[model samples]
Target: MALSEIPMGQIRTYGQIGKAISCQSAQAVGTAVSKNPWLILIPCHRVLPSSGHLGNYAVGEDVKCFLLRLEGLRFDNP
Candidate 1:
């Protein structure tokens, strides 16, 4: 899965994904991310901003945090 490629204890910024797939704008990646339909199955919560902020989530940040926590992902102070 594309999301699984993020690793077990790491995260990926939207801009990084955009750069990886030859996209020039992180906003484009963010738009696609917002449309993701797999929810926790695709680990969309693992995708975040480059600043280490939680960013926005259709399912709410709290829920997203819960999911990330379940995956052993920690959001540290940046």
Candidate 2:
């Protein structure tokens, strides 16, 4: 899937992923991401909402933040 192609330290919005896979529905992409069982292997953490904020994750938003930070992605004050 497109999620696997997303490099570490970089992120893609649900819409971006959808477009990559020829899907027009961001919500559908979000649903698929939410159901991903191979989180680490697939790097599902790299997917974010289009709002430029950290969105829902399988484990939790904190874990997602930690993962992203480990990959060199820094977040500004919200």
Candidate 3:
């Protein structure tokens, strides 16, 4: 699956995943990610804002940052 393709310690943007899934809008991808019912299985936490802002996660931006940081992925800003 597309989510599984994301490397363990890397980050990806919603727009990138959208393109992979043949969708044109990153917002659409974000919507799909927000609705991902699989939670940890889908690894939706790896998806971020195209501007590298981290955006609003389904849970919260803090949780998203924590998970990414736990994976050793660094971000300049949320």
Task: Return the top candidate by TM-score.
Answer: 2
Listed per model in order, the count of residue pairs whose N, CA or C atoms clash below 3 Å is 0, 0, 1
- Residue 56 in model 1: lDDT: 85
Taking the tens digit of each residue's C-alpha lDDT, what string does model 2 give over 1-78?
A: 789999878999999999999999999999999999998999999998888888999898899989999999996415
lDDT of 2: 0.91
Give the whole-model CA lDDT for all candidates, comma-separated: 0.80, 0.91, 0.82
Against the true structure, candidate 3 reaches a TM-score of: 0.86
Error of 1 at 67 (Å): 1.4
Models, CA RMSD each? 2.0, 1.2, 1.5
Residues 1-78 of candidate 1 have per-residue lDDT tens digits of: 456577765789999888888899999899999998887667778899887888888889888787778778765434
- Model 1, residue 24: distance off in Å is 0.7
Better structure of 1 and 2 per TM-score: 2
TM-scores for all predictions: 0.84, 0.94, 0.86
